[model samples]
Target: MKIGIIGGGSIGLLFSCYLSENHQVTLYCRTINQVNMINQCGITLQKKDSSILSNIHAKLSTERVADELVLVTVKQYHLPELLPILDKIPQHIPLLFLQNGMGHLDYLQKMKHDNILLGVVEHGALKISLSTVKHTGFGTTRVAAYKGDMQKLMAIKNTLQMSNFPFEIEANYNEMLIRKLVVNAAINPLTALLRIKNGDLLSNNYYFELLKEVFQEIIQVLCLQELEDTYFASIVSICQSTSNNYSSMLKDILEHRQTEIEGIVGVLRNKAEIQKQSVPFLQFLYTSIKGMEYKRWDE
Candidate 1:
């Protein structure tokens, strides 16, 4: 199987290294410097005890995407810029989106492709450099077909699944994405704001309370109370499992890079407006994270 992974970030690199082990993988990088580095040195996947180097083809994202299956791993904010590039791809090729929010669904609906799959990545990865990524945590990837034939998608899923990096097919795309969105909305901003790791949310009483409040507001806005216990447990379990790892949003802030606040919290804000409900806590976190981005830009 030939796989083309868009975005050379942590998730993209991580997927590239694993998929390359069993299939032909091509990593699309935003810059030529990244392409050159990966081509020269290959990509390094670092684990706690050891590291594995995988040789994968690297190319600029501007080039054509002709692979059989493509994984779009870029941040939600970067989606708009890639519209032109995605438009050029053949519709028969399947495109799988691995993002942190549900906001991308709206954009995906407007695309011409018929084979679109959405994936929720539970694994935690950190990009150590242009050609290196550290797999901070191991988790399964849940995938659901958004606009494609289920049988075809299942075939793709079967080929992509491995013991180390498991991929499961979800029954509903909306449910899967919403569950992930709520978890991200409750966790990422708070972590980014407090400048704390995932564990702190549970270890600190005050933060845990705030997390519950935020979760309540989100469920109210989305009418997700019936699954409250399920979502809450999922969030708590993620924090406990990845306690020592800094969230992607926090890492972005620390590196003075733009965070995905709009995708995570901004999506909820839009829904709250539609339902004519005020999510004060959610709004606060949104503004607070946006302010931090402003500060990053100013400095």
Candidate 2:
């Protein structure tokens, strides 16, 4: 199997390193510097006490992609720029999108690909340099078929899965994405706003209470009944498990980069308005993050 990853960030590097072990992998970087670095020295992946270097092909995003499976690991905000490139690829090829929020769904639906798989990555990864990534936390990846055949999805999963990195098939795409969205809504903005680690939300009673309130508001907006108990537990468990890691949103704010607030909270806000429901907390977080972005822009 030949895998092509379309991002130079942590997730892209992580997937390229692991997938290259069993498959021929090509990493498409946005810049020539990253491509040169990876092609010249390979990719260095660090986890806990160990570091591994894996040699793989690297190319610029402007180059044509000709792999059996292409993984779109770019951020939700970067999707618009990527759509044109994706459009040029043949529709028969399988494309897996690993975005964080729900906002990209509508755009993805309009794409030309007949085989599209939606995936939620639970592992925590941080980019140390252009060609290096640190795997801070380990977790399974849940993938659901959006418009692809089950057999093809299974074959793609089998070729990608490994002993250290596990993959599971989800029956429903929307459910799988919503479950991840709920977790993101409850944890990401708060951590980004407060400039704290994931553990801080659980360590402080006040923050924990706020997290619960946010979770409740999201459940109400989405009307996810009978599963509220399970979803709430999942949120708490994720915070506890990835305690020391800084969320992707928090990292974005700290680095003065754009966030996926629209995809995560903005989608919920739109749904709430359509249902004529009030989600004051969700609105607050959405505005706060937007304000932060505005401030960064002004500076």
Candidate 3:
């Protein structure tokens, strides 16, 4: 199978290396420097057990991607600019999303084609440099056929599984998405607000209290969505498991890059307004992150 990875960040690059071993893989990016490096040398993938200098086809545009399966790994905030380019990709080919938040469904539903699969990847990787990627931890990726034909998607899933990728099929997708949302709302905001790594949030009571409050707000919303409270504990477990990881938001803030704050927290705040409830904690986080982002721009 020929697979096109849209975002050439750490996770996308890592998957490209792994998938390229047995399949035709292309790492697509927007930067000329990145394309030059991959073309000059190769993608340096440092795995837990071993390392490899995998040769991957790199491109700067989707003009060359004809009938390959595409994986959208770009940040949530960039989806609007990224999704419309699918017209260049063939309509019958499958496209899977490896994103970090909810709300993609509505945008995807607006597309002309429905060959979309929603994927939740748990694998963690750190992009140390432009040419280097370190596979930090292990986790399973969950995939489900959202609005598309399942033939190509199932083939992709089976191929990944046979290639020793750690992943599973989520039985209940709404529940899975909601559960992931609560976890992101709980951990991501606190880490971004405190300017701390994901693990450090657990040691700070002030941050933990803030997270608990956010979780409570999310629980109320989840209850309205008819989800049970048992999913609440999973939020705490996510923090504990990925405690040492740098959340995408925190990473963005530290590097002075744009964050998915609006996509993740802003979405919740919008929903809160619609529900006629005041989410003080989420509101505070949204304001704080936005303020910091503005201050950086001013400087």
CA deviation > 4 Å runs, candidate 3: 150-152, 224-229
lDDT by residue (121-214, candidate 2, tens digit) is: 9888999999999998888899999997999999888888898999999999999999999999999999999999999999999999899889
Range of the 10 consecutive residues with the lowest summed lDDT in candidate 2: 106-115
Candidate 3 backbone collisions, by pair: 199-243
Itemize residue pairs with steric clashes in candidate 2: none
- Once superposed on the true structure, which residue ranges of model 1 sit more than 4 Å away at CA? none
Model 1, TM vs. native = 0.98
| Per-residue lDDT of model 3, residues 1-299, tens digit only | 78888877877887887788878888888787888888787898888788788888888754467546888888777777776577667677788887776767668777666577888877888887766788887777888878765665676678777435666777556666766777777777778778787767677887777766787887775564354356556666777888878887888788887777876778788888888988888898889999878987888
Measured against the true structure, the TM-scores of the candidates, in listed sequence, are: 0.98, 0.98, 0.92
Better of 1 and 3 by lDDT: 1
Q: How high is the lDDT of residue 149 in model 2?
A: 92
lDDT of 3 at 215: 79
Question: What does candidate 1's lDDT look like per residue over 1-299, in tens digits?
Answer: 98999999999999999999899999999999999999999999999899999998999999999899999999898999998999999999999999988778878978998799999998889899999999988889999999988998899999999999999999999999898888888899999999999999999999999999999999998899898999899999989988987888898899999999998999999999999999999999999999999999999
lDDT of 3 at 70: 83
Off by over 4 Å in 2: none
